[model samples]
Target: MSSGDGRAPGPLLLLLLLLALPRSAGRRRAVVNRSIPDVCATCHIHATCQQSGGKSVCICNYGFVGNGRTHCQDKDECQIGASKICGNHTLCHNTHGSFYCVCLDGYRASNNNKTFIPNDGTNCTDIDECEESGLCGHNARCVNTEGSYMCYCNDGYKLETGEHSFHQDENNVSCKEIGCGSPPEMKNGYIVGNYSVQPGSAVHYECREGFYSNEGKFSYCTENGTWEPATLSCKEIDCGKPWLIPHTTMTWDNSTTLWSRVYYHCKEGYYFNGDKNFSECTMDQSWENITYVCEEEELFSNLSIFNETCVRWQKKTGRLGVQEMYTFHVQGQRWYQKNFFHEMTFELFTHKQAPEVCLDLQPGTNYSINISMVALNFSLLVSMTTQITDPPFPEVEFVAVKGSAPLLRLRKAEDQNGPISLYQVIVLPLDLQSTFICDSFAATTFFSNTTDIKGYVAAEFQAKDVADNMSIALGDRHYYGKFYNAPLKLGQEYCVFLKIISEWNKVRTQSCVIWAQIKNLSPSLQYMTAVGLGSVAAVCLVLFLSFSVARSCLHRSVHPPPAAVACEAVHLSTTVDVASAGIASLFLETESVSLL
Candidate 1:
């Protein structure tokens, strides 16, 4: 009835038609849901699908279908595409109609034909094989490959990991060789080392035999190109001991070194030979080139005569016989035996010989000998002597006269040897023993004529020698006489005497008296008688002249004339009147006058 065609359709046909319509609708949906159209069409055909937007429309092959909209998606072969996945090293991939996966090198798939889902290619990073233990052998370093690791060796060592091979051969890891060079040696007292030492490195040492090092044993190389702390040392050389001989002295400058100076000196009374004072230690360790002298005291003899003589002379007459001469000798034998005078033991030499010896040894004319001595060594000692000689005596004489007193004359006395000696003339009264009169008699050779006896008061006189040895009294020389005309008061019985004396020896001699009686004389009286007569005559003549003058004056007074008398009276009256008038006039003018 709907289309009135074919007698009524069968049920099977009707059922087939119904199925075809739903199927076509579902195919359209699959194609629309697939994302890439060409990729989905790789395995599917006769599928009506359209791509609207960015999705594909298709029918899935076998066990695949579109999830929704237009894309075709996988259906599980085991679950999804698990049966078609690659091995353990690979990742599984699914397509619209089929699926497949491949493994990387050095890896294989597991026996089960299932897909492998890798954990993550980018998630887990590779491990460093070089750092891991046992990755390389001893003395070796490890390096990593794409999927594994290997080992290489370092210097001075061999790798014992893979095979038992020598380090120097190929395929073996080995280290290069290294070492420290050499040990140090010693020379002289110093230890020396030659080595390539690094900065801050150090070395140690000790001293050699037969020598002792004063410094200690260690040294170090520092950064400043010098050794630190110190250096090794050897002992110093030793020499033998030194000494000086007995009774000698020595001195050294320094004790530490073998070089030294030695000074030597000998004792008293001993002498030394060549370079006796100094020596030195030479390089051979021996004292060399020595120096030396002995002890002495020096002896002295002399003799001479000692004596002198002196003589004097008179000054006025130049007479020599009037003076005396004296001689004396000085003698000695040894220092203690020196004697100025020795009458018994000493032998006296002549004045001539004595003078010759003294003059030769005299110091000079100005110097004289005062002391003399003889040394035990026969040395003669002489000094000057000073002597004073006595002055000459005086001479005197007495002379007599008739009317005057006696006088004395002085002269020098003569000594037969030479000059005169000093003399004194002394007078003393006969009655008065204590009354001594003195007079100086000058010394001379000739007699003096002038005398000095004006007073004649002295009674006796004496002449004395210069040495006071002789007097006129002892000689009995006639030197005085009595005066015949002497005055009576001077005494008529007086006695007089004269004496000559030598003062040096106190000698005197007296002169004998010449006695005489003194006579008295009277003056004449004729001049007294003439003077008395002449005085009487003069008195008588004066009296006679006085009597005559008186008689003449009496005769004239008795014979005057009368007329002459009258005229005389008148003249007197007139003169009297005139005088009275003048007096009146003077008195009237002046009332009073005084006369003295």
Candidate 2:
């Protein structure tokens, strides 16, 4: 008013000045809204007043709203118009005074999953959870859709806890191995060792005797029902190279592929102990589990002492008893012979040390005898022939002149009922006497037993052709060798006795077999001489013919025939010469054949 000059009325000017000054908030609260304000001063700075209910009231401005005094809520301009104020794919959320635009669950702001303002030029972009690291653990697959994620186990693996989706933080979901299916089928053999068939589990296989493994030796279970290159197979077992026995040479039918016996022998000057000398290559691809040892003769003081622990292997030399003539011994030998007990009669041709009783005995440096007999009782008679040779020690054993020795044999026990016979015709009658001979020997004894036996010796036993699934024993029970007598001094003779006892085992079976027949195998000198002379005569004839042919060829080459000479006059004489040369080559080959 003062500026307008003229000095307006003082009271009026004072009233106008009071209205110009701003009123305190506390004072304004006390004053009720009874009149309309000339300006927007009664309301918040951003608000205005309006008439309502016949009274002036504070109201929010067009872009702001609230109680109108303390605060002013901003209008969501982004949500107002039909045209999206926040733009496409942008979320509008009202804030304290304004609103913000952001992407939806699957959409991001400005190509990123972040909050942004609309009209600030930000656009929503899809979130790809799959692209993020740590979304899935090992052996898992991840897929993203919208704002969600999913996970799956890789091949050979399954989700843990039957879960179908991936987990974060808690990480409750995981991939676990879904082991391979049942292990490969085994043929000709069976699996052993490991009991599990899960992935990474291993199993071993073994082939039966006389067979080998043609495919996998050992196999393992793998992921996804797959095997890691290992397969199951078996053909026949192969016992590679003989069992490792030092200082011994192996003797086996090398022609055989498997399960053949491998006999061992100590080198000269070395003697066999009770150690193993023979082991069979079993179908399980393993040699008989027997240990062997050899000692030197120097360790033994008196060689004859070994006679007590005698071991022998004998071969046939001849069949003398069949041809020789001798008196009936049934009358004289009845006292000591088994014929007295069994009522069996057989022949014998022998020389003994008794100067009186050996009346018909031929005088000899050493005891020599020949014998051949047959048991009239059995259906088929299995014969076993034996011959002995001088060993590195004194071998003949002599007892007091008495019949106290046993005359028992397994053939008597073979009559037992209900037991299977080891050999259909293997029989040896015992004829032991006080003055009989004893020597070392080795022998193979085959016996089959029921389930009661504690030490099972054989299974699926096979010697030459015999085989079975039942338990059995082969060879000597203690020595593990073929039974035989040793060191009869070649030309010398021996008093042989056959005896076996069938004790507790009523189901036992055994037999005796000959290795080979006796024969005089010496070649005739006359035949050898004749063959040599014939060969020499043929060689001489060939040499003479060769010389004659060479001379004829020389004559032809030096003096050409008239027909060949005529060819020289023609223009094709060189070709004619070549043809003649070919003919000469033919002649040479022909001569060579004739010579052969």
Candidate 3:
């Protein structure tokens, strides 16, 4: 049997309904009740129940969508995109009952958690990897991006490995300062000053000696971390072929550049009469001018020296008995006297086959004689030596000083008379000044005690050691040669003598002069004595000036043209002979000469 709502009922439920229906009489006349379903118990597993209008109702959960009582299912919140649903830089994931927000790569949750639920203002922000120092290695810069960061080298720097960018963990990643390691080398050139590898710096260059350049002399560091190639060019300074000089043969190489030399020598039957034997290439691109001449040699034979002061030479047969004018040039020197020099030239008229000339020469001297005959175009050279004689008298300026030793001047003498060997300074008691002999060697050194106690050798000097106008102090306590210049005794009167000695070829000679006299030596009166001596010297100087002026005037009157003595006659015949000689031969020999 079915119930009243079309439901079949069991016998038990039918009997219960029959018993409850007849017992209601008047109060229960047709009394009936309806049963209501429980809405909470009929809800879906993925849904929840709630109250609505004071009655229980069924609804879907956060991540579910359905008619709550019949069925409920998961709704994909990520279908619309994580950026719109969960927030920017985030991912939306749906669970059975709900959805959550997670950040993407290189981003983090703003809520400081790994995951979050949205709708509470939670979001994802860019993770700043650059915030950590040294994220990029040295010399590199770190930059942040939307979700990441990049590393780059600074200007004027480059990656050591040649990469454009790097990170700190990369092996050997370094940003090294840009450099063109060393500037390119230039031929015959050198760097001028300091240089750096940094961008925009420059290296300067210059050509070395004997070289030059007109091109760029700089190499610059560019922004690309490399040097701009150098453009400087160096070239050797060539002076070109040297100019030819007449009557000479050159010894040279084929180079005509700076400092190159071309040596010159006179050919046969000629003599060099120039100060320089070589010409040099200069920086002005030319060979320097030289005062070089090759004089024609005269025809002479059998040249001989006689009487220690005369020369003779046989004339050429072609010029026999022809009245030829001969010139004699003489030069004298003494080996022991460096200050001595004698030079003279004279003319002689001779018609004899053999010409002879006697010279008035100095003693203890070496002489060279050159004889030239103009007509014959030939010459002869001869040497001679003179025997030693007594040395010339010593020239001195005598001084007398009281209360102090005097500083005396020594004037050097020329070796016109003899070769000067030694100079000696002798100190003696004033009483012995009259007994001093010019040839005496009895004076012992100041340190030596000898029988002649009245005198001692204060100083001695070899002629080579003495200079012109040298000064010597009387008691300076210095040594000259092996003799000590000892201090003088107080209150003693002394005499000083200068002696010159000459020794040559088993002959010895000497000369002497009184250099100074000191009387009543006293140190206390030195300053006062100097003042007195100054006054006397001033008067003497005035007198000397007056005498010199008068003497000069008298000398000028005696010789109106003093320069005439140094003037020499230049023979026109000699010049004509030299000019007429074979100029072609000079050019022929010059063809083989190379410029250097």
Candidate 4:
């Protein structure tokens, strides 16, 4: 049967039967009954539940639930428990078996949650909303709100972009803008606005018009970014063309500017401005700084006569010669002494007439006279003077020897005059001594061949005068003799004489005597013959020894020896054949046959 609730009666009956068993069995039945609910509810409950095998069984409080499986899920407590779990200033959030707290409205969760837990007070945290974009104005500060922020600019500042606040951090920052003034202006040759006028920028330099900038162009900035250091100069300063001065010629080209050359010359009578010959123009537009003068030409006379002074003769000191004369003029007049006088004899006349008289006085007959003139009117008188003359005939002295080549020499006594002429030399042999005026000088050289004449040989020299008068004789007699070929006897005496011839046929002679003795020579024939014999004997002995030694060497070389066993085995040999059989036999026989 079944229970009234439509439950199966079998389960109920089984329950009763289990209970009717013994006490221990029945207690065991009750325990099994209790385990059945846990197992059954595990799959059907939420939250708090017991798990049976793979199923969960529990029931959770509000905002918490669980599936019939193992896991539990939370409900949005902030939405569902808004009024109860969280206060007005907080929010609540649900999680598995719990709820989170969060601030609401102007308040925020202290723990940073969006929901609040039941009975958990909410903490309202300050919100730094100023960190968000657009929270601060440009050049302004930002303030945080409960849930928002506000922007405000600083005093005396404005935003770059017109807005309550700039959205970006970089956009909100602002700085003052810098502006450039006007650029400097240039005048004259230069144009304005040529350079940039920005602050701290520089303006370049340039020249103006005909005036070149001495330095760089002066530059200054105006209030409106315009600058003009100073007006560029345009004043006219001309370098004029150079000009030539009077009586001067310029050498420089017209195109030259700084330097130019000008040459100046003097007129016929006037001098140059500087040097008499030339002048130059200077850069200061002035002529040569110096001057010169010219003088007149000097005059010279063609002919004039000055006074004559007395002059001593160059060749003769106090006297003069007849052939020498001195003639001079004074104011065109000739003065001289006429007759070889010792004092001045004056005569006045013109140059032509004076020269005529001088010619007359200078004739050949007056060669010994010397004349000279003194101051204008003074005349030097002179006479014929003569110097000492050398004697015409030269002295003759000489010596001669018989049978010898005799020489005769003539010399002047004073050596003042030159050589004498018209002189003759003579000789007389021993046979003609009496008549020996033989037209030759004494002892004049002669040759003889006869060997037996014994007598004095007389020789004489005579000098003839220009009048053809013969001078005294100069003679030299030499005693000589020719003897037989035998040696001359010792202690003999001899005489020799010499004579010289002079002009005018004058002759002078001299003589000398000397004794001569003969000297004997020693005889040496026997000593020479002995030396010859010794030399011959030495030669003959040398020849005999050489012949014997050569014969022995020939004999030894001609003989040969018999061959020996030991000698035949060796290759060495001598120029003389010692290995021959004949030589060996001879050597052995000689050795064995020595003299006993």
Candidate 5:
């Protein structure tokens, strides 16, 4: 079947001959067989040649990146001249056709913070561990840095770690307040309100009773935690009672019996109601006080008369619808002690003043006769006030707690329909000394040391109803007495004292002490004792008659009539004789029975 020497058979030769023929059997193309020009040479330096779509085309090689045909340039994926082409905070490395992105210092990436690929949806951001407050240990504040955070301690506190800050894991940071100064102690005055006061609190300091404000007052706690002004002091507040003036008796003018004007005295010549003089003392005893005061005793008297009557004289009296001129004839020799300020004043009485109502005051020596004449109504009152002023009133400013005119708040002494209410406000001298302030006065050790604690401007409030002659002492607890209801003019100024006297009792609670504020003070003050006198005399007469009737009955019972006495004796004798006869007959019967 096979030809010798591997020759093809007729059928196989015909197939080979057909395969060797051109793809088109019809015709053959005339080829200009000049050597084919190198197509790659027409392209750019970085380009290469390729045959595609039955044509020899010049193209840029895949590994060699370029823009387009005709002229091709090598593309730099690494962007060596123009940065950020890869991405910020990343290192770029040129490759065959692309670049590699490597994260730089303090940078991160979406896939991997240290290593990143270009065009990835991730950014290199700072590692802000400070976003958490507890990043640092206690009492430390966190501060963010490039890729880390820091800690710092607060003011006024110390860290136990010894450093300013420490990490949370250390567990050693603890804040403690800084040390302060030592606690302070006060003198003389104890803490007025609270003793155990803390820092940032307040403390009030005051002196003892009868003592003036020597040093301590108001103070505060410092940041160092101690009282600032810690010293205080108090001095004695006493000058015992002034010695007795010859032929004069003195008494206290307050119900407290201790807090008010100490010695209101009357000379022997002046008439006084014995019943009203409740504080007449004749003995002396030691006193118990913050400052020593003399204890008073009852007036000792052995002298007595068979009978005596009092004409109870008043120092100042209301006008009986008349004008009286009273002259104070000071001895001319005493004028040497008087100065420009030694002037007496006659203050007019009236809440509602009329310009025409004034006082005629003539301040002169004994030779000239200091006469004060006043025209007042029977319902009106007159007061003789004198003062040896210092520094003068015009120079001083008047500071009323509220104002010069205060509204009176007292029960009506009499209803508006009835007699008018009468009130009295007595303002004593500011420098009222028990010391012998006059030249002619006897030299005595009575008021030796009464410098600081003079009666702290005591006041007596009294209300009277002239119609009923009934007086009431008012200043009870209900009445707010810190305010004065006296009629004070706006432009006028005078000496005043405000400290209260602290003594045996609270005078403010006394009804009589604050009466002026309770009732309106009238310009008129009429003392009407005659109205009650008749009633008192009637009561005494009734008791006298009652005693007389009892005495007559007692006399009758003590002495019996003579005839009754004789009859009683006769009856007693007859009864005795009858008893004796009966006894004798009984004895005889007994003897006869024995014989039988």
Candidate 6:
């Protein structure tokens, strides 16, 4: 089978011929050595070795074309239109030994992959970019095209550059909302506050001073780039005639317009008792209400004092039977006691033309009574003096103790009935309790060194220093104000009296109560006697020991002359005399302590 001008077939061609032989023919030949070279190892990196007709052959990969043994170059699959190679909306890319297909911008593969091959029916489709929210800037709508998206401003909004459509890459682009210029004017009204002309903003209006409005007071911008109609309407103000007042003469002009005034005056024999004398027409379409009043010239007169503590007054002729309120102020003072003062104020209501009221006054006090008519703003002062009387009895808790001094409760005495001058606690012998007189000033203070001192004031407290349930120990030996509380005599029974004195305007009165009765008092008396005896004995022992020490010291000295001994004897005798005097003084002191 030689061709024309045929030399023996080349090596490649011969290899092809051998591969073309059938399997039966290869079986008829002798077996060759198994150490055959691998033709795939010799192929180019980009080429693959494959079996064809029982022989291994080197072939370039799908994306390349070459001789396969030495070189394989990338093939330009994209040389053909991408639409034909990778379907619509795609781009073909050639790799070293392969190729890939990618959808254009705004387009996606049916397999949802970035790159694909059409072999699996994977083609590029248009991507609905609007599905992504805010793909366009605010106030704009996104629209998808064949391979890209566009942004269009919404209604009542426009792009900054006045363009209808824009791309996301233009970051400076924005859809600004439309504005409805300035708001419409309102009749007799003016703008109130600042407002924006953009949609959904409002402009507020207010009526002028002399005008009023009952309609709406605002105009708003509509979404359609127009101002909403304002229903606000203002009208001029017109105030009516002033109101009439009783018993008043009105001085008003025929004109009853805004800011107009009407004057009023009281009739003859009447006085004005109002804050303002005129009423004015105001902006509320009516006259201003006023407090204009007229009252009798003399609301009250003919004031006099009759019953020494009662006052009487007559109302004015025009207001004879009308009910009226009066304020009474009374202040009382004592000439003898500068600090004694009393004052009171009260209101009284009566309809009688001749009204009389009795005053409650303190005894022996000079009082100035002021009766005032508050409605008439008039007051009358009268002087009066009350007669003196005995003060209220003292408040005391009577207590009796048989074995010791009583713990007395000094209840505070109220001075409502009279002025209190002093509080006295007088102690007396039990036998003299019946002879004690509250007015007797013979009782002296505890420290008064006087003979024939039958009884003394154990304590005296001022009225101000006394409290409710105050505890007072009878013989506690403490000072109360200027009075001393001396211990009671041992083995003696005593009576305690509380006396309260009231002295004002040179009038003196007093009340007394038996506060406590202490008798026997054996326990404390025994204890006192024992303490006194022990003190005296201890003193005597000390003095005797001192004297003995001096004698022993003298005796221990060396032998002395007769004259020296006589001098020593005299010294000893003087010391003995001092010791004897000291003992006697101690005994007297003990006895005195027992007598308290």
Model 1 per-residue lDDT tens digits across residues 1-596: 23367577778778888999999999998888885446444534433455657866555445466533344566644343332343234545665555556444323445333333443332123344445675455566666655445555544333334243332223545432222223345544444464444545666665544345545566665544345655566654333334333335556654433456667665554445444576655444344534221111100112233343222111212322333222223321111111222221122132231223333221111121222111111111132322222323233343333322233344434432122222333322234322423232222212112342222322222323122333222112233322112231221222333323323223222222222222221212433344444444434443443354345445656554556446545655555555545543432212111110
Ranking by TM-score: 3, 6, 5, 2, 4, 1
Q: Quote each prediction's TM-score.
A: 0.18, 0.25, 0.40, 0.19, 0.26, 0.32
Question: Ten residues in a row with the worst lDDT in model 6?
Answer: 587-596
| Model 4 lDDT at residue 175 | 23
lDDT of 3 by residue, 313-356 (tens): 78768767789898777877665554566889899998889877
Using alpha carbons, what is the TM-score of model 4?
0.19
Looking at candidate 3, what is the lDDT of residue 194?
Answer: 92
In each prediction, how many residue pairs overlap at the backbone (N, C-alpha, C within less than 3 A)? Answer: 94, 26, 7, 82, 15, 0
User: Which scores better on TM-score, 2 or 4?
Assistant: 2
How well is each residue in 16-40 modelled by candidate 2, as lDDT tens digits? 7677665665478657564545444
Worst 10 residues of 3 by lDDT: 587-596
Cα lDDT tens digits, model 6, 1-596, are: 45478877668878777787866476655355455678989998889999999988999987888988898888988888889899888889877666799999878889998999789999878888888998897999998887778999998797767677999875668898899887898878999979998889999999988788767888999976689989898887766445545557888895665678889998776677768998787775666655566665555668777766787877878876788888887877654444567889899998897988998888777776666677776555466778666667777767888978877887777665467877888888899899887767433444544445567777778776677888888767787766767777656898888888776667777888888898886645556676677567766766776677567667877665677767756876676667656654543322111112
Better of 1 and 3 by TM-score: 3
Writing each residue's lDDT as its tens digit, candidate 4 over 1-596 gives 66689866687689877877777887998899887655444543444555556765465545555553565566665565555656555555566556666665555666566654545544666677666665563456777666655565664444545444543344535522222355444554454446554444556555443444344554654433345466455332222333223333445444322233433443454333334543343333223333332222211112222221222223222222323333442211111121222223343322221222321232111121222322221122222212222333344443433322323344433222222322323222333344433233333333233333233333333322222223222221232221111111112222322323323224332222121111232223653465566556555655665565556556765544445323432322331233343333432212110010
Query: What would you estimate as the lDDT of candidate 5?
Result: 0.38
Evaluate all candidate structures by whole-model CA lDDT and list the values in order: 0.37, 0.43, 0.75, 0.38, 0.38, 0.75
What's the ranking of the predictions by lDDT, best on top? 6, 3, 2, 4, 5, 1
